[model samples]
Target: MSRPMEKTEILHPSLQEVHQSVDTTRPGSLWKKIFAFFGPAYLVSVGYMDPGNWATDLAGGSQYGYTLLWVLLMSNLMAVLLQTLSARLGIVRGRDLAQANREMYPSALNFILYLLAEVAIAACDLAEVLGMAIGLQLLFQIPLLTGVLITALDTLLILFLQRWKIRRLELFIISLISIIGISLFIELWMARPHPIEIASGFIPHLPDEAALYIAVGIIGATVMPHNLYLHSALVQTRKIHRDEAGIRRALKLNFLDSFIALNLAFLVNAALLVLAAAVFFHSGHTEVAEIQDAYHLLEPLLGNHLAPILFGIALIASGQSSTITGTMAGQIVMEGYLQLRINPMLRRFITRMLAIIPAVILISIAGEHAVGQLLILSQVILSMQLSFAIIPLIYFVSDRQTMGKFALSTPIKMLAWLVAIVLIYLNVRMVVEQISGYIIQSDSIIGKISAIAGGAGFMILLLITWLYPIRRKSLVQKGYHLHKPQTPTPVMPIHPYHKIALALDFSEKDHAILAHAFAQGNPNTEYLLIHVVESVSARILGKQSFDQESQQDQQQLAAYVRMFEEKNLKAKGVLAYHRRGKEIARIVNEEQADLLIMGGHGHRGMKDLIYGETVNYVRHHVHIPVLIV
Candidate 1:
């Protein structure tokens, strides 16, 4: 007889595809929806107060004073424009900006944009590390390097927090925002200036050459690149139902959300600039690099107690709040572009090390001045990176295929293109300035040619990046399955009251399986960890006599118990039971374990009889959840 028609089993769709299929709805409570909308922007706000921003704000205030306040407004306006587009793209398209860029561009163009993005993120990370170091310097008098090393421990701590619910993370962020707001507000109030002069500062006016750099600094601090990426990703976290009504409400609420949060960000940034302008601008201090200068200057005017505490709080909040956002941004980039799945701790470590290593090496060799230069350089790099992302954002939003009925109006598209062109031109000019001054003598003809060429090449590259997605059909297909509908899964909640017992045979495979399960499982539920101490392998099985074996078994059990306790696992006990005598199912039955998870492979002999020595035996006997890894 012909072999029963052999057919390949249909493969299950990936978990990600399934997740995307789920429908989202606007929250019933307007307040809750408003709160959720503000969630992602906080990450963006960190860029405004990071150590790099501190450096620029101090430099600008001390040099140009209130005259440069207009730049802060311009840049914040720029940020609102770009970030709003990013948010709209996310809600309407069901994709973050980075992922959108990747799908739309060619392989070569996508890779370049990806490389720049990685560098931009790394720059943000460096600023975060330095900010943390500054915080340590203020709080504990620790050296920057030591403080940098201590940051590694924070990754593990952050990972631990991931076990908690998402709402808890939101609460933590809100608390940080409150701290940052209070600290900055007090500092601004301390630096009281003439109301007329402050008002004129907000009005547009060009200052001297010395003030130009400060104006640039204020602009740099406001229009940060990572904030754009962050806002896009954050808007996607909402559960907005796909219908027109839900989508429209999400748009309205999100715009309101951006308007409120970004306005506050503007106020905080303005406070930093004002404090600097009022205190240092009038004092003939044109170049202040360290955050300490802000405090020292204030000491004679605002008294010792308020000044020191204010700067210290600002520094601490700047570092801590930015670190959380930087870490999350790394997660989004890796997952978005590479489609790589990584735990939060591992991703944080990788991103932190990359950002810190270069910073430490450069700081050690070049000192604080070099670190300050790196901060400015990071912003320049951000401007260059922004052009690549912005062009695509404008194009995609205008495209009927992606935006559907929500495609941009002609005026909006025109405005977006105008913004893109201006950003490209400004970025190009900055690159030319850097090349002429740093790469060659500013007066040399060769330097001028190189600078012009550099600017031209950069603009060309950006144009290519924008055109790439429109040209590559194959990549578009492979990179994103845009029309795939998300499937809904029944929410199955494991009761916290239900006790679970897990049995492992001391194999690496079993340990790996348990780790995966734990990462995917709810932490609220209680679980018992058990390591069976049977004489299974030759290396460990026959090495000891009966008394020695029992002692070894006891020791092993104790160690495992301690390990679980340290990891915050709800391990009940580690019992030394021989598989030779006790049935695995029978033991689970006695212990009243609602679920049984064990190694898939088992050895023959009394092991099979007592332990249901193999998975088959246990399956036959246990009427419980048996997960064989």
Candidate 2:
């Protein structure tokens, strides 16, 4: 005879295969993957031309002209390299940037890095919301505070998009980018910039102190922190294995898509600079703050009022296109770092609300110039926060154990090291510059000393961040355990709806005993009423022709029998049961029944006799807490 299969053996696949097969091919051609890679990168370009970017670009143009356009080339290249690394790490390792960071490093390091990254992204988001509100103010002439509040409504808009195909949604966003792209391209065409000057801008030479600062600001504006987070998480959308081939594919395509999108961004940014340089560079335009300035500057060359309208369309497109990527990135960061899941709408609202607060408050009191300063400073915040993400990506990609053969090569490691060093230097420079500026602005010697002391203290905080994780982990691993106070367990009150099950047969005395037991005992525990119908003897009865009709109707009669059993219980009960065609122990084993209650009849007959074999079978079969009544 053949052996029966065990239950566990029937349910699961081999462990080795589960991770190997992730559903990569759905309902589409190869073009779908190409389009998807295009989606998130382009969505991120919103940050590139945000009202904040507008201010920085405006300042660079008004104060320095096309001198800083060279920065976009380098920054976009950096963005492509880093974003691709992030995406490849996520796709190859099956981990988000934060989770990967947490696993690759000591626990304390993970938590600290996670916290700092969250704060930095949140700060960047605040600036984006502020810029959106400012854009609304420029376009619609709405109150800044009201515009900020209205920006929260974008959450609802994003949530509705979730029901559509992600591809279609991406295409819609791409279309918007194209609209903005073409409009900007047209603006660039109409501007008729001096070809030699634009070429010189690309040749990379800073003319003065003002030019150097604007160049730094452009680099900061072009490469954003959230794009790195967004790209890494987005790469996971494509199905990729941990093998070198999959990593190579993901790395190649992601970098290609990022390069293309960012290059487009670079062209648009350069056009903005060239347009500004041509129209306002030496035209005695000392301070130009409005969309009207770019338009007014262009009217002389375009000989049409259409330029302002096209500029408005482009600005709106820039704001509208980026909203989804920001929302999606917010979702990834929240879920990745905290393991918190929320609908997209609520997450976007939280980010936008935080961002809008400072933008509105400052813009209302201080004007667009202050808003411009906020944008520049926000880039500084972005660059600083980027290290939170970059450190983790570098650490994990460089790890041979996790990545195996796909681990970073020496050349890649060197590149990452360079990126890390540059980030640290930039952060330090920003801090030093801010401190020196504050000292120069102050009147008293005490204030200068305080500014210097604060800057030193801030640097210490940054150092502590990197060291705290290692120290905390070391102390804990050394067995110097820190204990937290335990809270007392709560007393749970008995519930009236509580119940208990008492198995039964057609015995009046058994029903009476159960009624009395319930009346005396607490009602907190729930009863699971059950009936077992034996069907192994069904064919035996029919073949014997003693109870042929009754045997045929056994399944139908089981429900009525249960109802009769419930009727006899007197008190209320919940119904539950198992059936068997052979040994009663089979059902007991399957249900692991808490108790077995069968009648010991007040009758004398061979059929009514108690069976020790049945009781012994149940006792041997189950190991749970059991009762026999």
Candidate 3:
């Protein structure tokens, strides 16, 4: 028996570029050190105060007064603790929660987790898109469906912003947070909430079953599952030394960042509840549960003209900020869990479309009231998926093998487990209560039976996950391996002429192709690097001369040739201007090459058809052996 090889390389996504934009050497002032760790938590905090949360807070405040405020406070404290652990996982282990899960779990279990994560992200995005739509409708008198369509354009905005410095994106989100905070401050001031009552609201009391349901909603809305995944990955955006002292400093600064940003979120949530309690509850409108209800009622009850406008502004800001982070989380989860990568723009479009489709159908069929219910239901779905993320996080961070010297201490481990148990219990209770309501309200016998069966299966799944072993050594022993018998090696046949023509596109994949080609090349083999510069709009109009393009290509080709020459390989550079596939075939034949080597994108089906298969075209045209990487 033999052990599998260990994976040593760190994975770097586009967000990793943030590491280059900031100095993390700890050579600055105390404030500067704190500033470097500030961005990720703000991104995480937006999930806490997004429009999904606004519905729960507004509903809780208006219906139950300040009674559910204690839930809001407790959930925020839990968020701070969990987010700190998430950041520690990234800083210490150099992997996000999704990547960590992929590394730890079996293929079947990893796929299950990936599906759950996608569902959770789609649910979160649904709330955000709907919130943005409602905000547009409230502010600009647009239809709900029209606003939903309009919200899709933010994908372009994200694409545009990401082209600039990452720090600028952070500042933009921070500015939106400031707008939300200011808006809430103005609304709270106008409402004149009772200070003593607001203070008493933190005393931990649930009035009835209805309060408990809303309390669960508050927890779901606060400790978002995607935020946990996002934070772990976001912490990796800082360039930190891979040493104990560096990890310690980064962890401490990240804790402060999470604490401050989450507390700000806490204030915003509390202010929303407090404003509702003062204006709606006091005015005998105890059932103002939806956000639109709160927005419409604010102007008449508070006698302030800017109240509704500010509320709508805050909603839009929250939705837009949350949409950005949600899209990033979708990318992180897909790449991390499944090891599948797609263009960020396409990924965003797909996730946004998944959310938008459901929202549009429901809004069209059931109207705006259904949208409000769907928002709350989305948070509930997030709550159900929270345990899948949290349990793995606690198990990994507490394992000495995974965390090394940065592992959680005994006391913190106990506290984290306690938090896990409490959350699990709350989730189960919510699920049971929801199922019981469905079973009782349904008229069809089949529907009742189905609800009961589904609830039982869900609970069983949770039980299995809870009891799953977390010890690393045992898991490694049970892991599957592909074993093959040893066989004798065969000798290779050499060709009389050895000349290789390498087509260069200067893409990242080109490096791999070059490495493969060089590994197979011999000292006697001659290599010619060819690059073609196709004229822009040549297909639409006529071919135009591109002198500067030819010069740049020649420079790039010469640089590559020098690289090969330095490695003691015989090489030459050729620059040409024509259609890429046709010119590459021409170069291979004119150079009298024995083989053609080129890099390819490896796309399939419609993508190959849409992008056009240059490698396929060149292969059909060339007479020699064509190796496509």
TM-score per candidate, chains pooled? 0.74, 0.67, 0.78
Q: How many backbone clashes does candidate 3 have?
A: 0
In order, the Cα lDDT scores of the candidates are: 0.66, 0.60, 0.83
Report the poorest 10 consecutive residues by lDDT, candidate 3.
475-484
Off by over 4 Å in 3: 1-21, 444-446, 471-629
Which candidate ranks first by TM-score, i.e. highest?
A: 3
Per-residue lDDT tens digits for candidate 1, residues 1-629, read 11111011112211232222322443368565566555556556667667777777777767777877787777777777777888787777666666776666656766777777877777777776777776777667887677777766667556655554445665676687778779877776776677898788778877676566556555655666666666676676666666767777777777777776677777777787788777777777756656756666677856556776767777777777777777666666666666666756677888889877887787788775575666677667766676766777777667766566666888988887787776666666666667657656566777777767877788789767766666754223444432344798999986543656667666576576567447544655456666555554423543343555556666765676687678786666554445522456776777787777776664543343344445766677777887777
Worst 10 contiguous positions by lDDT, candidate 2: 7-16
Q: Per-prediction RMSD in angstroms?
A: 11.8, 16.6, 7.8
Q: What digit string (tens of lDDT, one per residue) describes model 3 on residues 1-629?
A: 22112212453442454543666775879788778777889989999999999999999999988888889889888889899999988787667788777767777877988998999999999999999999999999999999999998888777776565667788999999999999999999999888899889989878898888889888878888998899998887787766667778889989989999999999999999999999988889999989889989999998988999999999999999999999889988987877677777788999999999989898889987798778867877887789888998888788776576788899999999888888878877777777798888899999999988988877776666656644346322222111223477898896644888889888788887788677767888889888877656333332355466655766888899899889888998877665788888888988899888898867654465467678878998889888888
Encode model 2's per-residue lDDT on 1-629: one tens digit a residue: 21111112212111111222333445568987555445556666666665556656766776667777777677767767777677666565555565444434555655666665665666666665665665576567877678677877776667567655555666787787788779877877777777887777767777788666666666666666776667666555555443556456666776777777777877777767776776677575747644445655666656767776677677666766666776766766665555556655566777776677777778788875575566666777676666566655676666665566667789989997787677666666766887799788889999999878877865775666455444432211221111223578999974443333345443454566456445534534334444433344433442333244434344433553465456563233322222221234454455444444433434322322233234434556655433444
Model 3, C-alpha of 122: deviation from truth (Å): 0.4
Name the candidate that leads on lDDT. Answer: 3
* lDDT over C-alpha atoms for residue 353 of model 2: 66
**Candidate 2 residue runs with Cα over 4 Å from true position:** 1-38, 105-112, 241-243, 289-303, 367-369, 443-454, 461-629
